[model samples]
Each structure stands twice: as structure tokens, then as C-alpha cells.
Target: MIEFSNISKSYGSVQAVEHINLKVEKGELFGLIGPDGAGKTTLIRMLTTLLLADEGNVLFSGKDVVKDYLYVRNNVGYMPGTFSLYQDLSVEENLNFFATAFGTTVKANYHLIEPIYVQLEPFKKRRAGALSGGMKQKLALCCALIHKPEILVLDEPTTGVDAVSRKEFWEMLQGLKAEGLTIFVSTPYMDEATMCDRIALIQDGHILDTDTPTGIVAKFNYTLLALTGKYKQETIELLRSMEQVKNAFPFGDSIHITLRNGYSVKEIEGLLQKNSVAYEKLEPAKPVIEDCFMDLMTSH
Candidate 1:
């Protein structure tokens, strides 16, 4: 239920976001996947009416974000990357405060946040500053949902949390989606991109591609090879120097290599063997979203 049409934002001589356009359907869980300094937060701010775009318009539920800022603010709930809750305020107090600000009470919308709030109930008396990363996240989410807004906009909600907490948060998001709340989440994690209904991979203030995770992977035209051996760094360097190589990137314990035009997998293996690389494990792999993302970034 959100639309950004050719939106552009700038500060001084640098442009944070440029000519951006996107649409989030009602009840859809949309994701913006990008690394740091990729204009994700800048875009979110513009969409939430916290920051104005220099060009184009942001509309929420058919209302102009700039002209109906108050209406948008009342309809959308935003959770910033960092915890913005009052450090001294207890979890429950913070929740109550936000509920009151939105002309409601925590109890009034308790059912909406029950799934997330039950996890934070034990820490209700603890100061927000004293809560763990995951607890703080749940508390912030509770506050965001306290008003039962139609749309939820979260920016890097799992950045610093542990893996378990991150998984739990995603599960909670899935639960919220089942309730028909439109969610727009931004994350640096490529794996999380698969969790969304559709994602836009962004870099350098530009959108590289926007599609379903499986669709993006399927669009990778090049054959991929995963190579691992005794010498990892040397293998990477050798692959980069090879004329047959189109792209080579280290992914975890293996190096992923793509062949150039007119090159074949057998030729690549022959070349590696001729160089005495002592490679053991070598196999073709289906392209993943991260691989697509890396290729897109390298090509650009």
C-alpha cells in the first residue's frame, strides 16, 4: 500500500537516493536488500514522511506522504535500525507511552502485539537499556505495533542480534504477515531476501534488480563452479588471471567462478590442473540470490 515514484534525495553535493521507484502491495511483505550506505535508510525516511524527497512523490494508501504526512504517520509504524526507545523507561512504560501518543492504550491493541509482547512480558519491568538485544527488538516491535498501524516499516531490525534472535524475529514477521499487515523491511543479509515475497537488490543508491528470490537466481545466465582446495587465496588469484574467467568471488570456504564467453567447464578444469593447483572438490552449483547480487554489483 505504498508507492514511491521517481523519488530523489540529496544532501550537499552527494545524492543519497536518486530516481527511485517502487511499489508495495497491500498485505505483502516487501524487502529492500542492500549493504551499508546503499540508501536504504534514506529511502525509508522519505517513505515514512520523516524526510522529504527533492523530486517525485511518496504515496501511502492513496494519500500523498508530503501533503498528508500526519495521516501517513498515523497509519504507518517505523522501527529504525538502532534502538530509539527511551533508555531509562521500562519496557512496559515505553510501550504505554507510544500507545498514548497514538491516541490508544497498550491494552487496547494488546491482541495485535500479543505474539511479540508475550516474549517481552518478563522484561516489562526492566529498563529498556538493560534489556538484551533480542528483548529490545521485541519491545520496539511491540511499541511499533501498539497502535495497530496498517503498514510496518522496519530498517535492519536484526543487524546486531544473535542468530537465534534473528530467526525468531523473522518468524514473528511471518506471523504478523498472516494478520494481513503490510511490511516493508530492509536488511543487509542476503539470506533474508529469500524470506520476503519479493525483493529489490540495491547498491550505490540504485536498484540493481527487483524480483522474487527464485526468479533472480534463475536469471543468472552463467554456469557457476564452486572450487575448494588446499590453497584458497592462490586459487582465487589464479582464477582472476585466467582469460576464461568472467567473474570470481570467494564465498565462504569455496571460490565461485564464472566462465567467459566461448569457455567450457572442461577447459577450466584442464587449465587448473595444468597449473598444479591441487584442487580436490569441484562441482557445479545452482546460482543463489547472493551470487546474483554479487554478479550484478561486479557488472555495474
Candidate 2:
């Protein structure tokens, strides 16, 4: 439903996005996974017709986003990365305002947002600014869905939401997908990448890889040795110094090490024992999205 053909964007001397080319199929939940300043919002703005690309084309349903901006704008529901609603307006008023702006009434699309709106109904009288983060999140989502656009573009929607709210938000997205809404969501959270149908791992304004979560993990060609110990940093430095270790980085409470020479597991354990690094655990593990992401970033 969306396509970017060699798209690039820049701000003065710095490039925000670089030659991005990707497609989003109908009813597909696609993720733009990256950290802050990774150019996700820049790309989203082009897709939403809010910003023009420095080069190339952004097409939505075969319509050029620049020359045919009205169609793109009218067909998309965009929730930006930041909270931008009127702080003084009550939740219900904010929803009504957006719905009216789209030439529709909230009542007309009540079925579309009922699941999410029901949660915000209790806080209907509360001013948007006075609502908690999670409540504000729900309210924003309701307003976005009030018009029932063909595509939904969420830019880091769960950035500051609590764990429970984050989980709720993803659940709502899944429900929306089942209703046949094409969603283009971005997030800096690595764990959320697995929740989407497919994801593009972006960094430094470059797309490292785009694939299903499992496919990305399968692309990891090295053996991952997850090591946890009291001396975590020391173990990582030692592993990095070893000629056999190609990449060594800390992940969570464990240090993930990749081997260059395909040495035996016994050999690794022997080396650690000889060095007396005092590790609590060292073992091979299946590759995850974060591991694949780090591997891609480091290699790039």
C-alpha cells in the first residue's frame, strides 16, 4: 500500500534519511526499528505528505505523495512521536475535533475504535494534559482511528508508556491488523520488532536489513556464546582481545561473543578457565532480533 523509491532527505549539512526504498503491503504490520535520530520520523513525514523528500518518490496506493499529497493525507491516520493534542481540550473534545477535521464524526467510526475508546471512556471528562501517559496514549489512538483511514502510521507511539500500556498498545495494533488496517509503526525498542509481521532495522540513517524476525535471526552466521559473570566487562575485553573471537558485546546481564575460527565449545571453556575470569555461565544460545541488530550495526 506504500512504496519509497530511492528516497533521501536532508536538513542543511546533515542527512536525515538516505536512499530508503521499501514497500508496505495491504494489511501488513510493518516496523521501522531503530534508535533516536535514526531517521524513522523523517521517513514517516515523507510518507504522510508532511515533508517532501530531497530525492526520489513516495507513493501510496500508486499515488505520488508529493504531487498527489491530498490523497495520501486523506488516506492516512498519523500519530506523531510526540504528544501534540490541545492540552486544554477534554479527551472527548480532542477526538471529536480530529474526527470532524477528517469530515467524519466519531460516532460514524465508533465501531472501529470501540475497543480502545472504551478504555478512555472513563476519562472522557478529563483534560488531555491531565491524563496519565497511558490514558493519553489511548486517547491519541482513538482520535487517530476515529476517521478509519486506510493506513495507520505510528511514530514511536509507545516511547514513554509503561510496560502494561505498551503491551496493551501492541494488542490493539494486532486487533487493528485483523480488521485489515495497514500499519506502519516505528520504535526504538528491539523487543517490539518481533511483534510485527516484518521489520526494517535502521541505524545512522541507513537500513541494515529488512526481514521477518526469524529470518533476521537466521541471517546471523556466527555462533553466539552468552556469558554471564561478576566480571562482565572484563570477560568482554578478554573475548575481544582473543583472535578467535570476532565480535564481543554485552547483552542484558550476559556478554554475547561471536567466534571467528569456529572453535569448539570445550576450547572456549578451557580458555576462560585458564584465564580465571570467574564466570557464572558461558554457553551457546539461539540468535535473537537484538543479537541480529547488534551484529548488523557492528558490521556496518
Candidate 3:
């Protein structure tokens, strides 16, 4: 278990994170979802004892992170956002180095990494720098798990990887969670938020909201509709001009309109037709995590 109380961090007068308080249950997959400058990395560093929080306390399994930094470090595996592995070493050699540092060997904890290592064994002789993005990711994850730590802290592990590799990485994490490992990960992709048991949306050093995917979507207090057709931007501009439209923005190839009170499907459709907008389709659309996050960021 990991717990933090009123934890905050800053660089000079700039606040990186502020008053963050949360707990991660054993064997649960938790996520921190946000964009690049949302302070996810700062909070992760503090939790792993790499960066000290100027206020509050962080505890892991009843052990304070500051007071028991070394002991806590031994019980956790941390993978920063940047690729920090030995570039000159072979995939096999890199694993050996980390295992030795933890006073263990790959053979000792081979079972923990069997599923991931199976794919990497073919590239065992390849230098860390020679591996592809997906291969590098797998190698990094394998090295982090070499010690069989109780919890894994990964920061943006799939940032530059291909779509297929990103999907595979999340699948591997699900396997780890089933083996009773607490997984705490951060990602900028809002679509990935639904994969976790619970998620906290952060922006500008503050947590906007924390809840399950469905719970977050339930908080969106508006009737959402997807509009896709010719003159998409014009349709958005038209919707934006109406006082009844609560929100209007482009979502992929479609425009998402949030209708206000008294503006139902009929009124919106009539207005669009009056403006000579050729909409191929317009229908009620359910809100997702992205929609909820945007609302929180704007209203709060």
C-alpha cells in the first residue's frame, strides 16, 4: 500500500505539485492521467523518494518515504519518463546489472519476468541502444522487475512507442496486477484512463477529480451530441454563436455540441438547417473521460 498526505513540491517560486493526498490499495492498477506539464512526473518522483516534497508526508506500507527512503526504495521499482538504461550494454547484460544491484539475479526472479522476457530473449544479444522502441520498452520494464519489487512506478512508459506496442504493454501490466503487484502508472492519453481501476486527473499542480471512468463521465452535466458532415468548422462556429449551446468544439472529424437548457435535438437541428449547414449525421453522444476532463479543467 502507498499513502501520501498533503504532499506538495515546488522549484523556487514555481509550484510543480500541491497538496496531493491519495492511497493506492494492494494489487490495484492506479493511473495518473494528464498532459505533459500536468505535474504527473513530479508527483511520481516524490513517491519513489527521488525528489523530496516540501510539505506533508509519503508512506509506503506504514513506512514513511523520507525516514525510510532506502528501505522504501528496496521495496519499489521505479521507471522514470526518460529512458535511463545503459545504452552500451546488451539486453541481457543490462538485466544482470540491475539484478546485481538488488542483490539478486535474473535466474532468481526469472518467473516474475518470464512472460516479458520470452519476447526479449531473441534480442538478448542486441545492445540496449540497438533495440526498437517497443523492444526498449520491454527491456526497460524487464529491468525494473528484475528484483520482484512489491510495487511498480512507471512514468509515461509508452510515450513514443507504436500503437501495437502500447497495447501490448498495457496487457503485460494487467498480468502483473493479477500477480498481486500494485501498479501505479501515468499517461497523457485520456483514452487509456478507462484501463485503470481508478484514475486522478491533474493539471497545473492540482487534482481536478479522481474516480472510475464511468464515475467521471457521470459528472458531465450536459446533453452531448456528435455532428459530422461538410462544413464542420462552420457548424461549430454556428453552434458557438447560439446562446443555448453550452459548449462547441471539434472532436476528431466531428463537432461535439453540449446543449444548454431549452435547446434539445429539435432546436439544434433547426438552427443548423437554417444556417445551411450540410450535416450528414447528428446524434446523441455519450461523454467520455476526455469530455469530463475538459469540463473539469474549464469549470474549476
Candidate 4:
């Protein structure tokens, strides 16, 4: 339902987004994965009609976003990274306010936000500032969905929330996707990238890669080995110094190491033994989305 063609946006001399061409299929949950300052917010703003692109064009349902901004705004629900709700406004009041601004009423669309609103009902009379981080997030989501817009555009919806809240929020999004809502969400968390139908890995104001999370992981063209020993730090240093190692990074208790071209698992085991690294566990592991992302970034 959304299409961006070579879209480029700049702030004076600084280019926040460069030549971004992307498409979000109808009823698909698409994710943008990147770190901070990766142009995710800028791209989302352009798509939501909050910012104009300097080059190329953005189309929402075939309508130019710059030219048909009001129409696009009416059809899309946007929740920025920050909590933009009024601090003094009660939960119900904020919901009503947003709905009214869109020429709708909370009562008219209660069913649409019932799942999210149920969590906020107890705090309906409480001011938004009084709610916890998770509760505030739910309240903001309720306000965003109160109007029942056709498309949902959320920018880093789970940035600073707790782990449990983050999990709950994603589950809620999955529920929305089942209802056929087109979702375009951005997040810096690589783990969340796997939750989307498809994800675009963005970096340095450019798209590194875009594909299904599983597909991207499958494309990782290296045999990954994880090593854990008493001296983890020393092991990482040793692996990095090895001529047969291409990329070595510490992942939790194990060090994920990539072998250089023309190297075999037997060769790696021999090398580790020759170095006297005293490793206790060594095993081959599959590449995850983050691993693929790191490989892509380093290659670029």
C-alpha cells in the first residue's frame, strides 16, 4: 500500500536519507532495522507526510504523499518514537482527542482498540504522565488505533520499554496484522526484525539489504563457529589474530568466529589446539539476522 521510489531527503547539507526505494505490500507487516541516525525516522516521516523528500516521490495507494498529504494522513496512523501525547490529559481524554481530530469518536471505533484499551481502561482517569512506561506505550497505541486508519506507521514502538512490555507490544502487533492492517514499523532491535513478514536492513542512510529474516540469514555465506572457554576474552583475541579467521565477535558466553576462505572445520580445530586456547566448548551454529546484518555492514 506504500511505495517509495529513489526517495532522498536532506537537511541543508546533511542527507538523512539517500535514494531509498521501498514498497510495503497490502496487509503486510514490514520492518526497517537499523541503528540510531540510520534515516529510519526520516523515511517514516516522509511516508507519513510529516516531512517532504528532496528527491524522488512517495506514493500511498498511488497518491503522491507530498501532493495528497491530507488524504494520506487520514488513511494512515502514525506513532512517533517519543511519547507525543499530552502529559496532563487522561488516557480516555487523549484517545478521544486524537479520534476527534480525525473526525471520529472513541465510541465509534472502540472495537478496533479493545485489546489495547483493555490494558489502559484502569488508568482511563489517570493522566498520561502518571502511567508507567509500558502503560504509556499502550495508551499511545490506543490513541493511534482509535481512528481505525487503514495503515499503521510506527517508528520504534519498543525502544525503551522493558523486555516483557516489548514482547507484549509485538504480540499486539501480530494480532493487528491478523486483522489485515498494513504495518510499517521501524526498530533498532535486530531481534525484532525476525518478527516481521519482511525486513530491510538500513545503515548509513542507505538500505544494506531487504528480505525475509529467514532468507537473509540463509544468505549468510559462511560457516559460523561458536567457542566458549574459561578465558573468553583471551579466546576472542586469539581468534582475531588468527590468519584463518575473517570475522570474530563475542556473542554472550561464546565467541562467534567466521573462517577465512579455503578454511575447513578440521583446520580450525587444529589451529585452536595448536594455539593452546584451552576451549571447553566448540560447535557450529546457524547465522542469525544480527550476524547477517553485521556481515553486510562490514562488507559495505
Residue lDDT tens for model 1, 1-300: 899899888998898988898989999889999999999999999888889999999989999999999999998899998899999999989999999999999888899999888888888899999999988999999999999898999999999999999999999999999999999999999989888998999998888998888899988999898987656687888898998888888887788888766778898889888998887778888788888998899898
Cα misplacement distance, residue 17 of candidate 1 (Å): 1.6
What C-alpha lDDT values do all the predictions have? 0.90, 0.90, 0.89, 0.90
TM-score of 1: 0.96
Model 4 TM: 0.94
- Clashes in model 1: which pairs? none
Error of 3 at 86 (Å): 1.2
The window of 10 residues in a row where model 3 has the poorest summed lDDT is 229-238
lDDT, residue 248, model 2: 85
The runs of at least 3 residues in candidate 2 whose Cα sits more than 4 Å from the true structure, single-residue gaps closed, are none
Error of 4 at 92 (Å): 1.1
**lDDT (tens digit, per residue) of candidate 2 on 85-137:** 88999999999999999999998999999999888888898899999998888
Q: How close is candidate 3 to the true structure, as a TM-score?
A: 0.94
Error of 2 at 246 (Å): 2.4
Better of 1 and 3 by lDDT: 1
Where does model 4 exceed 4 Å of error? 230-238, 273-278
Model 3 misplaced regions, further than 4 Å: 230-238
